[model samples]
Target: MLLADSPPPELQTLTRGQYDLVEYALAGAGFALLAYALYSWTSRSEVGVRYRPAVMLGLCVGAVAALSYLLLFLRWGAGYDLTDAGYVPTDQARLALSPRYVDWSVTVPLLTAELLAVCSLAGARARKLRASTMTAAFLMILTGHLGAQVVGEGRDTTALVLWGLVSTAFYGYLYVALIGAVRSSIPTIGREAAVSLRNAAIVLLATFGVYPLVYAVPVFVDVTAAWLTAIQLAYSAADVLAKVGFGVLVHKVAKLRTAEDVAAGVDTHPEAVWVSNVEHSRAVLPPAQPPAMATSPTTPTA
Candidate 1:
């Protein structure tokens, strides 16, 4: 069967009303988690320009993915009456445009822009890896954006070609950039690596674990399919949970890194360090001596 000919077995049988409820539940859960993560990051105020933008971009992509899924499968899904007209072309178009396309346009570009900005800033500081990182990020964002357009739009020939091109680029950049960062982090690479890798893993797991149900929908039993849809919704909710959880982790790790710097007497804040250094230097220096006078002349005259 053509991928589009039949609704995925997972999504096929649910009543529109039921799906709406599921969508709402998922959206609320996902948004909450994402928001919490952002808040946690904001609280730290220790975020470097590079990591700060990267974090926000990651959050944006994750959150948008969740939102798009909810709107496509639930809100718009409700427009089709199960007993009457099922999913329609217009519905598909709406789904494609509002959430999916929007996500595509926004997520990748925002990520790329932030990465470029960060990389540029880091480059100014002479970080050797900045150029490569910026390049990778830019390419990934471009590809992810293209893939989204294809899936959302459903124009087969063009969509397939575009998706293949962009997805490949995205994956390539993703691997290179990540591996490079990991290698650079060194000694503690495994621990630091978890931050970005774990998040990506969470997103992939969520996507695969949740999205295929629509494929299974046509073949499965209606009640069973509904249950699976419900399960998928839960999985999406878990995505948000992971984000917030990771956010908390990021915030804590940042704190620990900061504390370590302080304990080791390595000052990360240049301004503060400069001021302290100046004060210390002033305290240590001896007071200036008065200039000597020609005392011999005065004695002779007396």
Candidate 2:
């Protein structure tokens, strides 16, 4: 097993390649999420009003996260002075984390909203669940940010740990509430929506699990170049999954639900019937149009 001796950033002797890994991770996440956000925005017309909130939340989360990553990438580039020997940290190094907090603060609340949007709740129940989870998500991110600030300021580790614990309580609430809501909603929804929503929950559980581990890194290990590289990579990848990946899955659930509704003869968006055709084909449901329509000769007019 490799042990981190915990060399401070200035003394770490970080090579250009190692430095590039961190920079590229931030930039890659930014661009990918921005693209996803645009895709979500354009796809708005494809889903019905019932599930549109889910898609909209995805767009908002992806957009905010993309901007945050852009800031992080630029901040990372500016924070390092590339010398022949290695990369050295500048005064701007600490500023990189600010964008990270900003990303979390906005995206976290929005994530819960999207999750609720796909659930099978309604009326006051829906409103109540949304409020509770969104509040928890916001507090979770806020306390986590405060804890990180405590750590960054070289304050008492006890206070840092305390904040971490408090943040963790909110995190636990968010995780449990999200998972519970998703699981409960699964049995009540259509087949395609259920599967995608279940998958989204699984992905949510996975990506949510990754964050605190990354957040806890500084507490246990020395943030050497290797550790920082790992942290950047882990956090960036997690953000992509939790934001972009989650968005895609949420959209898929909403899309499939729209398909089910349209298949059931409900009036919806103009493109909904075609979207249903495609999704129903994938789900092995009854074909919206006969296969003969594509290959067979046209029937004579009446």
Candidate 3:
């Protein structure tokens, strides 16, 4: 049957204003994310080698998310038709959620990797922590997608709610892991670096919190034009902040720690910013002191 004839709960009829709003938001966010990803790419050379891994992960996250959003925008463009009332689905239609779920599955794990890269822990403990957190994040995205599929197939509120709760359980685990990582790293870095790391964690948590909120919308209200517009807008806003904004914040903390290490002579930066920093360091050094003993000592010895 045509989607218009038997529309899934995941698909919604949207007024022109609502459709335009979602379209613009997705396109704008895609461009913004790509820009930030490029920025992150260039910044990798500015930091110490030890912290480059986190910045690399952030770059990957941004690129993956940017591509997904752009694909979603294109899908939106082709999925619907301009009807008398507004925009409605064409014959064969599906929500652009598949791309989003695929994006989250990859990017979510990369985010956890980024966090762990900056973390102070090492060896087997670090490996264990990384494994658990990444696994939990992937499971969270997986379960959430299951909920969306439940909605797409049938308006099965019960299955959707159950899946949502399962996803929430995984999200809660990830939060615990993140908080622990932040708290543990505080004592290992300088005061400023610690503060930046802590703040990044807080902002990340706040931005990520928007996902569950967006996920729960279909649970609470019918997917009408206005509500659907709200959902798309919220998801787009959260995507930009969570991937691009959070990635930048993590990079800041990494850069700060690298600077701290360089200051203390614990780390060296041989690329990009280091060349200028080295010259500036030499310019500020005190002049060498004259020899205490004069040439007279050498004359007496002769």
Give each prediction's root-mean-square deviation over alpha carbons: 10.3, 9.4, 8.0
TM-score of each: 0.52, 0.85, 0.85
Q: Where does the lowest 10-residue lDDT sum fall in candidate 3?
A: 276-285
Q: In angstroms, what RMSD does candidate 1 have relative to the true structure?
A: 10.3
Residue 65 of model 1: what lDDT?
Answer: 58
Query: For model 3, how does the per-residue alpha-carbon lDDT over 17-48 read when each residue is reduced to its tens digit?
Result: 98899899999999999998999997787667
Worst 10-residue lDDT window, candidate 1? 273-282
Worst 10 residues of 2 by lDDT: 278-287
Tens-digit lDDT track of model 2 for 1-302: 22244434433556888888888898899999999999999999777788898888899988888888878888888888888888877877767566777788888888889988978888998898889988888887788778666454523355557778888998888788888888789887787678889888788768878877876766665567776687788888988898888888888888777777666665444553344345352222334764563567879998
Local lDDT at 94 for model 2: 63
Model 1 Cα lDDT, one tens digit per residue, 1-302: 12345443343455566556765765676567556646644553454332454456555655665566656556444544455644333344334224544544454344333333222133454244444545554564355445433354332334444555565555566555544443344344234334544454344334423322332332233334455456546545554543454444444333333333443454332212112123211112224688997565445553
Q: Which residues of candidate 2, in runs, are more than 4 Å off? A: 1-13, 151-155, 273-302
Q: In angstroms, how far off is 133's CA in candidate 3?
A: 0.6
Clashing pairs in 1: 8-214, 8-215, 8-217, 9-215, 9-216, 9-217, 9-218, 10-213, 10-216, 10-217
Q: Candidate 3: list runs displaced more than 4 Å.
A: 1-10, 151-154, 271-302
For model 1, the superposed segments whose C-alpha errors exceed 4 Å read 1-13, 16-21, 46-93, 96-98, 108-152, 155-162, 188-242, 268-302
